[model samples]
Target: MPVSQQRPLTFFGVAFAFLATMLGTTLPTPLYPLYQTQFGFSQLIITVIFAAYAVGVIAALLVTGRWSDQLGRRPILLGGLFAAMISDAVFLQADGLGAMLAGRVLSGLSAGVFTGTATVAVMELAPSYLKRHAALAATAANMGGLGLGPVVAGLCSRYLPDPLWLPYLLHLGLAGLAMLAIWQAPETVTRPERIRLRLQRLSVPTEVRAVFVPAAIAGFAGFSVLGFFTATAPAFMGRIMDVSNLLAIGVVAGLPFFASTVGQLAQERVPLSYRLPLGCVILLLGVVAIGAGIALASLTWFVCGAVVAGIGQGIAFRAGLGEVVAASPLTRRAEVTSSFFVVAYVAISLPVVGIGVTARLIGLQATGEIFAALVALLVLMALVLLRRQRRPVMP
Candidate 1:
């Protein structure tokens, strides 16, 4: 069949595949408390578990970032879905920290592969008329799946037959569906006659450096806030605010991700040069709100902060991504995008570990305040750097 005939069914199919893989990455967010209770671990353990996934992502990215550009998008993405399913099965059988950590690492591998490969695949599959909007659609699917995971998991854990097992089972089913859908979707990359495996290198080209630098910093800061919420916000809700409902915690945890989608949408109205700085400004404000929430012990303040941070992160994230994609050499696009995400996953993992360490020492409230302050500092730095860029990235 002609590519045009396959555009609608194929494009959306790959998008859904992207979403399903991302959903698996965060499926364990709300379930952390359950793991803590059962395993009797520390706050640091939570960060470590989450970080394990990020580490897996970085590892896969280092190995397979450009695989789609060589072996084609379809096969790499199929490998990603298979990884996700394996992670779910691992989670289903998890008995202690080791198994859970292993599961998360596998999940990370899945996300790492998908993050670059799937994003590019969705855009490649878009019909000509929808081309301009395809990038946003891909990003929305990424953030939306991430945001929705905890919510769906929360609900299942709260009311389902077995809290621990049911969510993974449900996701396992979704993974199966996504795989079937993607199997039918057309491959966008032309397969080379000779396929050789090469590790992804981690350097930015000279031209992309200006945007890459600020974008990585902004991405780091925005993702730091997101990491905190996903890893430990439930602890705050349960301990600081006295909320015990799993559903509520999941919903709150997901707010930033969903808000990020909104931010991405709003960036369409922003000028090419102003988007990153504006996003940093919004992110800094959100950090303040989060600090306020921590100081006052107000759930309302915390929720407000999350929404603001999400929006800021979304705007900055998309802006940085757009600039990088635009600036990259055509053949090396996926590789460069992978390098960017390596920074992001690093940001998501390390800072949250710091939160765990600080929370353990000074307690959650003071620790949260300090985290907010640190994030704000990074955002300001990014804003300054963005202002100093010599050449504007042209789309």
Candidate 2:
């Protein structure tokens, strides 16, 4: 169990596999506009479709949250990859909304299985000397990969021959490669274990509550940033800004995620105590920019806001996660992480749907300003709470 003796290659393999899985979940980000055109759906419908994916994620977290820790990381990951492959196939044959929804549902399940399982696998495989780096790797791989997906898809959609088919086809290839990688990677868990399958409710230990509250709040705020881009940014860019280009839409929509990736990279340098509050304040600035973008109807302004806000989200999120993981027992780290994800996904799902409703009633521009302001308020409240906790206690 020496720190130096752990196999770095196997550790990397686990990280890469998880990264691929997360990428697969977001691969469809740019394709939503195409789907909307093909299916003739409205903004509300699109949100519903995106929310369906979140629902699948929550369902998997509740059901299999603890299964991977007990059953072994390889099995859970392989299972997740299998589901992702199925999801790609579903999209490939997608002829209507039903097929697309099914594909999204499967995609969500794949993420649910992979997220917790892969994080544990990476840590289990890491060299003891690199244990702290292992945590950064987990957050970076997950968030960074998710950010990369839409960008990749956007490039392919614009430059490549086939937009829809090519992206999914590329994903299918990546997923296959990941499968091979996983098969060859080392298994972290010992055998002779019981596997239980049933609905499980989300829970947190009292010891973890302090870290959990701030972490979950940060997750909520960060993922809401993601939701704005993934769920609605494309539509806004194309329809409102008059930029109907696929690549532009994808890049603008993907800005926050990529910025977040950068933020996570910076987490090791910034102490956790400062990361949360500072991130919140920076996020507020990004929100302000987004609101201004909507008010001014400027594409450049909106994209700029996404980039700035994305960085704050990334910093806060990684710091929050680090705090929670530090306090969680290794035995149930994956479960705790899954709980964190469940909160994040809720933030991703509901608020974006609300925006969709607003877009329908008020207008896309107005809705954008409204959502930015609301999320800004939420981040402000979280900042106040986190600062209060950081204050000294009276004797």
Candidate 3:
């Protein structure tokens, strides 16, 4: 269909596609323990396997993050779906660490393509009056889909016949459906009569740096908390709290994301000047709560901390994204957004890897304390920056 033709349901269809792709990316979170047992790998190996996905994400962000601007949203989204399907296939046949790592890399590629493109596509497809609503829908789809992945996998793994095989198979089926949605959805990008693709370097404009830096920092801190829960919280729950139920583990791991969704929704009402700093303060409190939970080994404290931290992350991420997106010109929006994601993914990968290594050295509990303390410190720094920026100019 031509870009001019519009479908009323197109917005929802694209959002669903976003949800499906993200679901595939995080489907393995609750199943990591099973992979460890089957493949006989250490915690560090587990984190390495997880980090492989982030590596792929970073590569894709640097290479093709802005391609959607030239090629159109539907094609990039379809390509993402295809990559996700391949990742699912790898997981279905995964026999060892290498296979799992490959699957993660492929999944990351799919996510990297989808992240900025899907958000923009959804916003563009919305009726002029509903752009803000579309933004929320897109954000919800991103975080909600990620949050749902573990729940779906955990439920299937706990109750179904084939734990590991079932989740991937189901995700593959979802990917197929998402592909169909993209096929029918209207293209949001305007195509030139003749197209020439060129390598686009990842660069953030100087004009956007002030807003981008603090927002990116807040995103880094928020995503770090998410990374810890998704990558290591399952293991922590099993080893520290003696909670081995797959469903329980998945729910606890997903809490931060769920809370993040709530936080984002809440941010829409807050004044922009106050939102970022306020988010940082909440994030600091959440991190402290998590540390206390770890120190005491209390499930209640941990879960509570997850909820609090998630809310903070959600608020800060939305505020940061809003600032960066607002600061960028339309021509550079996708590149800038992708740059933001690069920072967020690095935060996701490095901190988790650090925890994995530190856990090996200092033990999980102590590692949790250290991670919490460091993240809290980062949030504080972000908070200070936002507050300083907010101060009235003394003429």
Candidate 4:
């Protein structure tokens, strides 16, 4: 099809594709226990495997994060879908640790490509009148997709024929459809006659530093809450609370993401000055609740904590993204956005590994309590910093 003649892609279409790829990233969440049983791995190994996804994400973000800006959004989106397909294939064929690691890394690569590019694409494609609505759609797609993965996998695991195999197969099919839709979708970036791709170093420019620093820190803390949930919540449920049902675990694990979506939607009403710091305060409460849940051995408290954290994360992450995007020059949007994600992913990856190693030594309950306390402290500090800094004007 000719470039201009191609059917225009709606915001929803782009958001759906984004959702599918993100969904694939977390589809294995509920299946972690099954993998542990089949492969005979320790809790520490499980976290290490999970962190492999983060490694791939950081690698891709550092290298090709700006490619979409130069090459065009359509190609990067398609590439992400293809990477997700490959990741799904690896999971379907996975029989051991190596396969699992390879699959997660591929999934991370897909996510890294999609994260910033898709968000930008959705915003660009939306009708100017609906820009705010488009932003919410993109946020929902990113976080909501993540939230759905575990639920889908958990249900499939509980009621379907093959728990591990079926979830990936379903995602593979969705990914294929997403690819087809995006292939027909219009490209938003103007193509240069000659493309020059280069490895972009990761750095936040001085102009954006004021907004980026606090926003990134808030992102890190918000994702830390998510990291703890996706990586360790299931184990906590099974090992500590004696809740062995995959479906239940999936719902609990998925709650934060769903709540995050709600929080993002609610951000439209919140004043800019209050959004970041208030979010941190909410996050602090959520983490404290999680600690109480762990210390008291109450599933109710844990689930409550997940919901509260999700809300806080959603609000803070959206505000941070908005601030970064608004503050960035048009030409550097992809790179700046990716930098924001780098901080967030680091929060997601490292803390889980810390918890994993610590869990092995001090026991899961104690480790969780300690992790929660530390995260709470981080959030408190972020809140203080955000409160002191001059608020950036929203575009």
What are the per-residue Cα lDDT tens digits for candidate 1 across 1-395? 88689788888888998998898898888888888899998888989999898999999899988788888888899999999999999999999889989999999999988988898888988999999989888988899999999999999988887889999999999899899878998877788899888998777888888778989999999988888888888888888888888989999999999999999999989998788888989999999999999889999999999999999999999899888889999977867887888889899999989988988889988888888888899998888887777556789
lDDT of 4 by residue, 145-242 (tens): 99999999999989998998999999999998898778777778897888888876566788999888888887898898898889888899999899
Q: Please rank every candidate by lDDT, starting with the best.
A: 1, 3, 4, 2
Positional deviation of residue 15's Cα in model 1 after best superposition, in angstroms:
1.3
| lDDT accuracy of residue 186 in candidate 1 | 84
Sort all candidates by TM-score, best to worst: 3, 1, 4, 2
| Backbone N/Cα/C clashes per model | 0, 1, 0, 0
Clashes of 3: 0
Using all chains and alpha carbons, the TM-scores for the candidates as numbered come to 0.94, 0.91, 0.94, 0.93
Instruction: For residues 133-155, write the lDDT of model 3, one tens digit per residue.
Output: 98788988999999999999999
Return model 4's CA RMSD, one decimal: 3.2
Give model 1's TM-score versus the native structure.
0.94
Best by lDDT: 1
The number of clashing residue pairs in model 1 is 0
Query: lDDT at 246 for candidate 3?
Result: 92
lDDT of each: 0.89, 0.83, 0.88, 0.87
Candidate 3 Cα misplacement greater than 4 A, ranges:
1-6, 127-132, 328-334
lDDT, residue 103, candidate 3: 96
Candidate with more favorable, higher lDDT: 3 or 4: 3
Model 2's TM-score against the true structure: 0.91
